[model samples]
Target: MRSGVSRRTFLASAAAGAGALAGLLPRPLRAQDKTVKIGFLAPLTGPVAAWGKPGLDGCQIWAEWINAGGGINIGGEPHRVEFVAYDDEDDPAKARTGATQLIRENDVKFVMMLGGNSWPGVQPVAERTGMLFSTLLPSDLSPSTATLIAPAEVHPIYNVTAVDWLAANRPELKTAVICAQDDALGLPSVATYLAAFEAAGIEMLDEPLLFDPATTDFAPVVTRMLSKKPQIVCLDTCYSDYVHPICEQLFQQGFKGQILSCTLDFYDQVIAKTSAEFMEGTLFQFPDFDDPALNADFINFQKPNEFFAEYNRRHPGQWGAVSWEYASVMDLWKAAVEKAGSAEPDAVKAAMTEGGEGLHAFGKARWWGKDLFGIDNALVGNWPVVAIEGGKARIKEFRSIPDWYDKHGELMKKHMAAYNQMWDQRG
Candidate 1:
């Protein structure tokens, strides 16, 4: 775009013959170009890195595609987008430090995070600076947090769709047990599942099991859960770390019941640990990109199958829960920036929520969740109910999240209140 001339060299040339060159060059070419810095603050290392790093990898591919297509056009000038990532290690202290550094040092206009455990660390910075940010978790949403939005995967809440689908399709499974590691991510999810199960008329075999994050052996947990002899097992949004061991335990303990989870990341490994037969009919929320349903008209992600293949190629055996989520947010942000004619945070934020409608990768979703999470920042639309049929992940159905919420909003609020998760109650 600089015509092979360095900025300094171009400035020198312009100064010497400004009028002649300016008259000949196109207006866009004559304007000074820029590389817009977008900060990526997530765990690229440490225990929860699988959930963080793969999304960053997908973002790299998104950046490449945008740049190759001549970058994002803002105010008639093409500006290349560059991502500056910080490894927060999924730690609160490190997340705060990373947020401060990205804001003060990198001067990024937007910051994307994996959210959940790390959200509290960056909350202050986001409030103080009014910096626009995107999170995967809508539980992180609150009225006071004006600049943050969840335009991609709406976690836990969408988990309701999976439960709803299972209840409709597999009505014979009447009793269930739910379990999660007791933390920000797990607690909200546990509450959501509790509400979903109640709405579907599924009886709880016991109170939802809570475990420490440092938990290693899941034999005891599985043993206790199986003692109840639940017709269904709900792994209520456990991290991929816990999902594996808990699933393996279920197999080893020889408990045969419907297994449900908020996610089944790298499920092939789970199948390997247990068996293809064992994983059959296992239900969860997230979908594999190669699924035929992704070709639907409402799906906005560009070349999802290609993206998934390339991600696997570059980071073998590493793709997990968040592999496509952060990149999906990038797509929304880029569109907002172009529409607003500036990359400034406030302008883009306004543009993104202009009509309370967003092009969520799944489809056109509305900015909902104010009544539930105290903010209408999460993009709510249809979500896929994924099932492992014959050891392959397949879309059982695409359920309308808003439709479900309309009927069961009260149930969700009740459970969220019971968990003391309603924004105003977080004291």
Candidate 2:
């Protein structure tokens, strides 16, 4: 690993050259000596780029802010933060290469991943090196993977909160049909929604309809789902690429009912494709950072409204569910590094999960998920349930995830088992 501190003599050399010369240097100049590099391995190009690129933008803002504030103080010495990024393009082979390169060649203390299709490729390398890594997907956690953590977003597990909120508010919607692409993301979400619906007393019209990832024609999928005459159409964790096309087909077909999804990114575009009336009342997770609820005391992102503004200004119409997630993970990481007094991967990992507790973006949360994922690496707490009211995504409420888990955890485990999604069951 590269040394964080620059090799420049200060107090000793100055003392020898002239008495009391060291005190003359400006404070900022003396503090700007060391650099700490972190790795960002995620897709910058491809179907999932929306989930990856905006995160990079947010991290850039975070690094700049930390540096401006004289960097993070580590054992009384401040070190400038730097991010080294690689575009994995959502490919497993490329993910493996990127992970190895980031850890071996660049020597990053920690790596952040978008964590879906490419995680399997990166997992072995991460385990071999004992590199501290953060993923947005808690599904990626397992007991064997000690240094991996899902500190920010918990993905499909959080989808339950939305369903719980929906059942409470719109209890009349009974039957639902679901469809998703056959992949790492789609399957687990299908299981989660299945459990949520079952717990909510919403009956399924049919088994989950799995489509190929390369499928372009959503007409058949939409037609089949609508044929069941279900009141709710669940797009169980489909990619943004798939969500738009399926939603367009649903709108074009004029099969009107509630639409539930894990993310409705760039909903403005979807609203344009479909009518505002058609998009209204749609339920999903992930709130816009500028939402008034983000100002709540439980919220941790600094000036979330300003961050949202800057993101939109720089990368217009591109922010999505994962826009701020990577930066939030960075927030936890920075705090842990400072507390550990070192950036060594092991030390940081220990500090991060010091007491099986963490400051999740939403609020104070505990490390959980041993029953579902066979590991307690996920930070479980309150997650928001968002609905489109007048074509804008608004947080309806902050639902407690642990509370939901407490009520229906066994049902969730049964559904996950049906899908063979338990960590030990995974290869």
Candidate 3:
């Protein structure tokens, strides 16, 4: 408050209730003074349900927590938030339609999306409406586009940490082969993994086995990747919908070597399907909230362990890529909004930029990148390299991404070029 109100005092005001956002919400969702609406667009009924719905469910709990705590403060009042979810079903056209409905019909102020083609589909609507958009995939980022951001899961940039940790620790694991769907998120990740493997001096055996989204059976794909017999098999940003089948196939095929991927969700189910031993050496980017390493430096990681315990108690036996992701974005956004003392998209965006090297849930980090996603705005920094330990995923190390970019910047370019996915050609 320029009125001499302390930051804590202002937040305390917002924490007072939904009335904090009295003038902020769109006309429709605003009723009495007790509610604010947010849009959760994800692949709800599609093959990607494991990745999408469960994550939105996490958002439900986040909203509940905030509301229970009073609500979010915009300037000096409390606004309890509500999420209005729409299932885009992972289709670009459906994503566009869902976004339009969310803004025009539901009147949501902030729209959280699974953010791939869905991002591109919904961007125009966001631009026209001045809605703040958050995406998990930084591939949606561009300088011309002002609203979209990847604050939580910075996709491929974070993936580099996993491969780096693998190379240094498991030095004997030399050769690697990769497989992933050929799309905006998948292809960039594959390119990054190829570059990371090169930087780590881990030979990429095959030219990267890519599959189509229409592929429901992962057996053939797994068979082809295993044919390379590389010490490690990299699953490059595959949707959990695909990860499960591929992992099951890998287990069936008896792949005993190191397995590296961007995510491993519904891990208990995967263990039930593939058994505990085979899934033991798996390396991934996202980690469980219960990890002790998270307790050290992350602020928005507020009670991630508590969140995990609660989520397990309620939903039990289901978690996926998007889990904790959109919620993490909210945590970052809250800090930025508080820093700016406003919720206007441009104002908040400026505050995020001014913060300079903002620290996210993974600890201290900077937001810098243009060599890859064509926008330096995507938050880049230390990412934890998670590995399976005693049947539970744990952060083995937090690796430096800027260091990797320094060493193999051009290698990443070569791989991206090889796949013809230079972000310009992307939709």
Task: Find the candidate with the highest lDDT and give its number.
Answer: 2
Candidate 2 vs candidate 3, TM-score winner: 2
- Scored against the true structure, residue 174 in model 3 reaches a CA lDDT of 94
Give lDDT: candidate 3, residue 184: 74
Per-residue lDDT of 357 in model 2:
88
Global Cα RMSD, each model = 9.7, 9.4, 8.7
TM-score of each: 0.90, 0.90, 0.86
1 against 3, candidate with superior TM-score: 1
Name the regions of candidate 1 deviating beyond 4 angstroms. Answer: 1-32
lDDT of the structure predicted as candidate 3: 0.72
Q: How would you encode candidate 3's per-residue C-alpha lDDT over 1-427 as one tens digit per residue?
A: 1111111110111111112222433333223445668888878775555446666666666666666555666776666678898999878788889989988898776777767766767777777877778777787877656677777678877788888887788899999999988777788898889888888889988888888866777888989989988789888887666777888898899888998988786566678888888889799987776788877855446666766666556655543444565666777776677677776677777887775677666776677666776776777777888888778988888887888888888987788788776667565
Lowest lDDT block of 10, candidate 2: 6-15
lDDT of each: 0.80, 0.80, 0.72
Residue-level error in angstroms, candidate 2, position 133:
0.9
